[model samples]
Target: MAIHSPSLVELHAFLAVARVGSFRGAAEALHVTQAAVSRAVQRLEEQLGVDVFERSGAGVRLTPQGTALRRRTEKHVAALEAAALALRRPTERLRLRISVAPSFGTLWLLPRLPDFHAHHPEVALEFRQYHHEENFQREDVDLWIALKAQAHQRWPRQVAAEYLVGREIVAVCAPQRARGVASADQLLAQPLLYHSNYPDNWALWAEAAGSALPAQWRGTGFDLVLNLVEAARAGMGFAVVQRCMVEDDVAAGRLAMPVAACASTGRGYYLCRRRSLGAHPAVERFVDWLRLQCAGDRGA
Candidate 1:
């Protein structure tokens, strides 16, 4: 006898009934009537020339032949359903353009991108290094991750902001530099590394340690925090930087917090998105995942 192919609808109905063990339950699951599910399964069995289910007032159970057939075909049916689902989803890849602070992108965000890609393989991300003179109105960026001072509330029109992480500045230096630094004064006696963008970081750290910045302090200044951190790691001087920026280095023992003094910089990392792109599915998924990542890191 020649074998006939079963319809996908019939196969789905059979699997649903087999899974739930009831025509009514399968109907509810498939959002069809009980009679429709029953007829579909009946047609499937007729085409196979074998009784697939043993029916009783209590419910239904797969027969030996049905069990064998289901075992062989369940995975195939699932794959087909998945393929159909893929076809139903948007065909074009979603492009998500994000602008992020340079240091944060390199030190913090880049390492965690594999996790994001594992979760959202469909989203194509393009990153631009955020700068002070970013023209959001002209740029085609969808999201921007930047540091915002507590008092700076100005945002472009059609932009919404969400706080991701707080900025806590900690004084860190090479292990050699931390050896004799027992007190805040002693720690301050050594050279200090300054970030030109935030030259008052040392003063903030001193205030947090209950010590005042000296009238004249000595140190080399760099325009970037990454350079300052490297200088400190090279034993040039102690440097004050945002905790997140140097967290990995601190954990790896490349840097040491000598004075145990940490001060809030009154600034935070903010995730801003264009209002029109707020409803985009890829944007929504990325935001949700990013928020979760930040929350987990904060708890850690």
Candidate 2:
């Protein structure tokens, strides 16, 4: 005799009941009426022509045939369920792993994340701070918010970089420190804080101000822009920094830009991604949003 093929619905109902050990429990698990579960199990057993389950006053137990069926079909059923879920929730596949420069993430991106999430809630994001000499190919990152000095800076093979924002330098100090300083010439005499990454920032800003630093001029050097900003805020010295790094502090009166002179280093942040992955929907969505944000920044 030919064996009858059971419907997927019947198999699902049977497995629910088998796993829960009761029709009522299965109904709860499957969010169906107890009668519906019972009908499905009855139809399934009739088609199979075997007692798949042994019923008792307490609940139910799987018979030898039911045990065999479950052993053979469990994994297949799980896979089918997962596929169905994936179909229903296509955004689950739109996860993005981004590597961001430490200063950029802390000073700019982090503050604006709420807006990003509000706009694109379906795209899942994971961020790790970008490290020096980090191998982009070896890392598990899907995108990078990397600092680049020039548009032509070389990236790993197959990686593409797009400019986001220029690193516009601003000379800042505490409000009290600015009081005694009437000119860039005078400000030059005060203590000057420095970021280790940009040793020539002071010289660049001074040149923009039509002045130059003394050959022996030096002060504290901080590796992190965050700490450098804090040192300036605390009146440790005058500091030069990328405007975005101190926008919030300046707005909140924690720091102040004391000079009208601004300088550019031909450096900026870039969005980097593998050329092959550029077609991903999540990548496209985020890149567009970020470009809009950068446009606003450039306008400012």
Candidate 3:
């Protein structure tokens, strides 16, 4: 008997269904109708002369033949993806796509990006603002910068990470709001502003400074640190913020620390990237620049 070869489309449909465990899910992933996905899978099964999936009340399950086929074809799919990526970047200039936490991107990186452009004239940089919980594997991002509890832990298997900088939580307010705050206890007496994600920042800072939060403390919470900084600068309330994030505001007299106390939660920003792209020239140059920036921040 002559062997039949399955087309890439058939293989893709089979893999999608196998991975997702549903024809409906595969259709959604492939951006086609469920009937189209069913037809593709049926054609592939006919060509192979074996049932690929066992249908049951729960959903589709891959048969032994399907599992074996998947193991053999997975690498070929990955290779095709790599080739497609290479073809998409036919330009001479190195292009880098980076996804950064929103606050860091707006408050920290945006201000220093011109320097990177100045230094790396041959590189084209694209930036995306992303939340910490987003999955980078599904995105086109080549690099990411975000806060993590520990620099070494909690990364996806496909990526690698390194410590970027430590965060020091400090109590800040407008200079006017700072006028009467002679001590940590006095600072806590004012209305408190909070970051929604790090609601305990003020509480932690209070503990570190050996001060108790006042029973009548009024508070407002914001989803992003950038908004918290703005609220602090407006003299709305005292905000416990990462010192590195509000350094410029503090320096420019937009915000002031009411108490000379800070707490390090052992959490810090980290630079991350797909392990495969770790050695790419563009990624290497960007990582080097990031380290230089951190060093400069420390020196300042």
lDDT of 1 by residue, 1-300 (tens): 865779888998899999999997887566566788899999998888999999999999999999998998899998876676456546333677889887778878998899999999988898866777654664667789977844455766555667787578888999888997888888888888888878888898999999988988878899877788889899998898888777788889999987888898878788876544423556777988999988976675
TM for candidate 3 is: 0.66
TM per candidate comes to: 0.66, 0.67, 0.66
Q: Write candidate 2's Cα lDDT for 37-87 as tens digits.
A: 889989989998998899989889999999998888878988987676556
lDDT, candidates in the order shown: 0.81, 0.82, 0.81
Mark the regions of model 2 whose C-alpha exceeds 4 Å error after superposition. 1-92, 149-152
Highest lDDT, which number?
A: 2
lDDT of 1 at 214: 91
Q: Can you write out model 3's per-residue Cα lDDT over 1-300, one digit (the tens) per residue?
A: 866788888999899999899998887556566787899999999989999999999999999999999999978987886676556553522778888888888898899889998999877888876766855574578888977844245777555667776567888999998896899878887889998777777778999999877656669999988899899989899988877888888888888986889898667778876644422557767878999998877565
Q: Give the C-alpha miss distance for residue 264 in model 2, angstroms.
A: 1.1
Residue 47 CA error for candidate 3 (Å)?
43
Better of 1 and 3 by TM-score: 1
Model 2 TM-score, 2 decimals: 0.67
